[model samples]
Target: MGRRTPSAYEGKGYLQVKASNGKCLTVPYDNGPAPPAGTQLFWWDCETRWFCASQLWNVVPVQVGTADANRTAYRFVNHWTGLRLSLGPATAGESGGRVTQDTCPK
Candidate 1:
């Protein structure tokens, strides 16, 4: 994965994260309006097109409550949906995950 700081961040500290495939990582528009939990993420052309704003993320360092605590873990916060990324398909693991989806809390 790679990231580009969109001009929109304007030194505000958000990142537009993308993959080697040249696609921006974003939530699915198919499940609109703002998909629910477990709605798997999707890849798009990074066009700044409608529904693509969810691709912007903030990298937050963890300072507490981890197995090792003290900056050992990080969280990626979605700009649009305001949800943290999550691993889905219950059976997924470190080897690989069937999907990475974000939960929408009501």
Candidate 2:
């Protein structure tokens, strides 16, 4: 099992995913309507932007395989709505669709 460095945002209530180019994974405020579940998550080119509730995420640890107990990954759950992030069937094609939130699959 591999270990990762502790993030500065750890235990800060919200997890911010930043891209190599300095952009952040953001859920826009003006997402047409209220309730951010169906809103598409995208990268925003901003350094000092206020993160709204929709942009906040809860890290959910998920264990994979039985090889090592420490080997695990994470699922991002929206803070506003308790939905897990997923690539829907519509986005499975080569074209790829926007990242949306959905019910967690068992």
lDDT against the true structure, each candidate: 0.71, 0.62
- Per residue, candidate 1 scores C-alpha lDDT tens digits across 16-87 of 778899998777665457666676776778856333457777777766565765555667778777777787
lDDT digits (tens) for residues 1-106 of candidate 2: 1121125445754665666766656666565554445667777654344545565677888887776556778888766667777775666564657777777657
Question: What residue runs in model 2 are displaced by over 4 Å at the alpha carbon?
Answer: 1-13, 31-36, 46-50, 64-71, 93-97
Candidate 2 structure, TM-score to reference: 0.60
Q: Report RMSD (Å) for each prediction in the order shown.
A: 3.5, 5.4
Model 2 residue pairs with clashes: none
Lowest summed lDDT across 10 adjacent residues in model 2 is found at 1-10
